[model samples]
Target: MKKNKMSFETSFWTGLAEGNPFREVDAFFAFAYLDYYKQNLSEMVIYSRKTKVYKQDNPSDVFVLYTAFNFFLKVCYGLQKKSKKWKVKDSLCCETVFHLTSLTQEEYENPFIVFQKAFGENTLEEFELFLCQIVELSLSPHAGDPDAELTTPYIHLIKMLDAGELIRERGVEKIRKTDQMDPVA
Candidate 1:
């Protein structure tokens, strides 16, 4: 939740130059999630401005950013699905999974494709585990003081999933039966 003054553009450029784009994108997402948790409009505005500048200055980087963001969302969706207390909307989760699967089929793939290859038939399970690792990382002491009431985006997300708060009202279906006269009678 702390304001991240580090320049995302610089980090991305450095990572790109060093041939380590994945790490940079992942780090950016972590910071973005922290900002989101804080709900700090000013910080978010600054972040957005910087991203826009970066995207304009370097168009190819947009695809890298898109892939990274989609991967993050896919992981989040997986976590939501795996939670016993909560379930992501079937359509939404299915669509994300489908997209990720398609990406894995491509020759030049997102970094998550490595997970798909490694997990084979149990890819979904592996993805959920990967997301669990992220949750654990977010909960680490260096991230913040766990006892603090203020929740980071990662904490809020985990709490929501565990609490089943994401489930829709229609998640539980009701069935009704009424007696009727037999037509053959």
Candidate 2:
């Protein structure tokens, strides 16, 4: 008998549909996007200099952005899974995040418009800041454990997304700063 291996995409879709709490889909997408970006870092640097024209020429950038949006969807799913004690407003926020994930790439390209249509401008701004913070943490040097080198970034990303404030408040930032300032004695 032969065993079949499930592809990452298949597993991802299945996890989404099944509402699996441990799948860590956001982490997977984040790591994938980061790997892709690292591979094309030079191109991105060049493209940054020509932002207006870059979008017109670089289709992959759009795909990468869409991938990031997918991560956001996964984050919402995780939030929903863990929202058992959440207030009505928190539940509604989770629903809004999940709904935003349904928007097409064309729709998400103008995120302000989509957000305004679904949530409000304040939510849009906050969401954007959240994404920016996630990306900043993803690119940091000590985002993951040294023993699990390949999965370090993904681990950090998953923790950040799951906890929401892990990157901002008493999470990775605090740990990293403390580790830097004081030696483990």
Candidate 3:
């Protein structure tokens, strides 16, 4: 007999829908999307004398950004089909912090569990740190282009997390609090 421990997806999305993307187990994915959802990485970088949004600095940023994008796309796809199972395009999939990244399908119908196993490496701390690094980098004045699609939300989420203000919690409590309250009418 096996017992099921709550998964990062459940925990992360619970916090996200509630408004907190920086919760304990969900911080990594939260931070990952902190920048990813801001813009599409599939586009090539345009150089400008004014700012270096995609200046050739390190490859890791691209890696994490793509990973974040994949995560988002997977979720969106899952919801559209009413199934959490999703198939990631190979170009956007990544397995580790040291690889070129690859695409893959959710083997267990559980995206977060697969994500945890693929990148978690059984280290929540590492995931948290990775998230922090992405968040800090995203905050840089010269990080991604301010006009880029991903910049605004990414920055906004980072600001909220850095301030230690957890987003609204999504769960029975929220429903209970909302429904149990008297109507204004």
How many clashing pairs per prediction, in order? 0, 0, 7
Q: What TM-score should be assigned to candidate 2?
A: 0.27
Candidate 2 to native Cα RMSD, angstroms: 19.5
Return the top candidate by TM-score: 2
Residue 110 miss distance in model 3 (angstroms) = 23
The Cα local distance difference test for each model comes to 0.33, 0.35, 0.33
Candidate 1: clashing residue pairs, number: 0
Please write out the lDDT profile of model 1 over residues 39-110, one tens digit for every residue.
Answer: 332222233323223224444544443334334434433333233332223333423433332232331122
Stretches off by above 4 angstroms in model 3 are 1-29, 33-53, 83-185
The digit string of per-residue lDDT tens for model 3 on 1-185 reads 89533322433333433222223324434464423433423222222112344425764565555444334433322222322332222323434532312213333122233433323232334433434444434434354444444333333223322221111121111112235678789
Instruction: Give lDDT tens digits, candidate 2, residues 1-185.
Output: 99543222323332443333234443444345533533343232233333233345545554455355445534433443333323211221223444333344433232222322323223433444434443333333333222322232322233333333221122111112223466669
Candidate that would win on lDDT: 2
Q: Could you estimate the TM-score for every candidate?
A: 0.23, 0.27, 0.26
